[model samples]
Target: MPVITSRDHPLVKQLIKLEGSAQYRKKTGLTLLDGINLIQIYCSILGKPENLIVSESYYEDADNKHFIDIIFGHKPPKITIISNSLFRAISPVKTPIGILALISIPALKEQAYSRKVVFSVLLEAIQDPGNLGSILRSAAAAGVNNIYLSKHCTDAWSPKTLRAGMGAHFFLHIHENSDLKHIAQQFKGTVIATSIQASKNLFEISLVGPTAFIFGNEGAGLSKEMIQAADENIVIPMPGKTESLNAAAAAAICFFEKVRQERDSILSSNIGTK
Candidate 1:
């Protein structure tokens, strides 16, 4: 095929349009995975890209060539090698990786919705994409099995959020605009909602069974409806006078505490068995 030399090329414009809108990606059923690392993650999760765009100069390099060959080893997609300047035009990052892929977004399978999900992150009208992305990265680290985002939450598929999340998006089961109360009802375990003013301390609370954490937006915090919907309200004890911790920071603390407790429990059991 011919090289796409112009920034206004139809495919380039289409990919750029997906930069801001999740709706466009949903409608088109195509999501842009920027940079080599993210594209590699995409390949690992979603299979070979339907199409690959690369900078011509980088494509000629032996190292990049080998990496591209590895990625395309299974069944190579149509590759569009363009000039450096043109690649920069399409890239969203400051230091463009000069590589990107447009891949099909996998449909959420029936198995993804489970009544026995151990841990999940709940986003209530979180507007900032960075915070949402950071929370996702933290959640993935802390072993969260799913993420439930309210209708008003930031677009998880947007470019900025995707970049911040790195490759966390692939591993997460994200359900958008889901009913918080109904989902919580399905989960028999504890429902913990975090806030600054809550009477109970986070560490003191038992993270025993399946648990869901509700973290609200930075400015508004958890809404009354979300708080009421939760089974228990808890707070991360702060000895200092800091009014509130960042939403993402607070989430990391809660999630890791659960992980630590579970890990210690397993170790204690093994020691007793011995």
Candidate 2:
């Protein structure tokens, strides 16, 4: 294991660049996975990370030796041990977990909506990394395989988003920098968007078929073009005094409602077949 002492080391500088700049991440096709959980997830879903950076403390700590052994088992990648301070310098979180993995972003193909989907999500201009991550997590939990994002959305692979997403990035096929209007108009299935004034109720509708849900920016909400392009503008009714829902909360509710509807549909189909 190589020990990187200086913050100015080429590898250290590269990790900083990858964390600090989305453009750099895009240019290099590289991103940092913070913590052991993310690194383990990347290893399981994709493969072993290209490089693993460990804090010197972890290297010296007798108790954690087995953890490191688990990481490098058999086919280990390049390993570098740095001082706790130097490790923290490259860490995205304030409380450093003493480990990181450098890996190429999985190349998820961005293609047009050719066939109808059982479930898909289109996100428009979501700027908050946390919100975007939560939405992605929810989408994955709901069994959504495909997601499209507008150009203005936050970088999905950023450490904050990745942490917030909590490994959803590995499961999801994310298409970034998409044309929202074009996708909304071109989508073959039921394109649904939440609107306060809409007469349609979200639970009343059928989400069993090819359905795509559109969620908009946190503050500005959906663009007029996207809403206009959608096949249906439905609203999640809140009889309570809460005037509005947080973007992440709303997304989760919308996603799981589809899950519920689909479950019911499957049961009904099974009964009919019997």
Candidate 3:
């Protein structure tokens, strides 16, 4: 109910701690949500936040007021309205969204293998949060039902990543600390790994039924251990003098190729039935 204008407020300090320290985020089991859209989505899926950081400037916005009334009228989360200067200090981005919330880390879904067509994304040691987030967004958009993040991958709930993902986390199943080989076997799909040196082009590969597409790190690409574990390794064709595509770009291509193939398969089936 009250505004927190001082930079020294305890809640402000907590946010400062979260912004700088990943360990703190992990320990607290809470991470920062920068944009209003993300916060809104998180709330819809996960319920009320423990606290909300609002900008003094937009605290009275009509739309925001209506949203607050509907979602938080009875028992709102602790709203800590801060001055523009102090809000900037706690926000990760340059332009603060005037709305940020502390959200609990989502629980991972149990791994399953029953779906006839399942696509899971494997980010092998991807260091950049933005890239990983974009890939997750693409994976969800391309109809991948699940995502498997290696232990070495970036934090899926980090602020930067959550923003880039644009709320893709809610729509897809995510598994961390996963074993690709075992996952591949369980899904009974072609365990395809993406690599530049592979002789097989992705287009030529028969990506039908269940398939798991493994996308490696941005710099070193797939670890030799992961590559050795894969049932099939393929490469996307490159026509440019550019050495190769970025990891996110490569992933989009491979994922959509699978989508294309699946669509064609369905169309053929319909034609035969007719």
Root mean square deviation (Cα) for candidate 3? 2.2
Model 3 alpha-carbon miss at residue 94, Å: 1.2
Worst 10 residues of 3 by lDDT: 180-189
Best TM-score goes to which candidate? 2
Q: Cα lDDT of all candidates, in order?
A: 0.81, 0.86, 0.81
Residue-pair clash count for candidate 1: 0
TM-score per prediction, in order, is 0.90, 0.93, 0.90
Tens-digit lDDT string for candidate 2 (159-254): 889988989998888999998888878887899998676889888888877889999888888888888888899889899998699999999999
lDDT tens digits, residue span 98-201, model 1 = 77787777676646456343787788988988888888988887778889998899888776677678878888888988887677767767888887668888
Score residue 16 of candidate 3 by CA lDDT: 89
Q: Say which candidate scores most in lDDT.
A: 2
lDDT of each residue in 1-274, candidate 3, tens digit only? 4667887888899888877776788789888888778877887888888778888876868887677778776888888788887888788778886888887877777767565687777767888988888888888898888888888888877888888888888778878777765666676667889887788889898987888888888989988877776788898877888768877888888888998999999999999999
TM-score of 1: 0.90
Q: Is candidate 1 or candidate 2 better by TM-score?
A: 2
Local distance difference test, candidate 1? 0.81
* Candidate 3 Cα errors over 4 Å, as ranges: 70-76, 111-115, 181-187
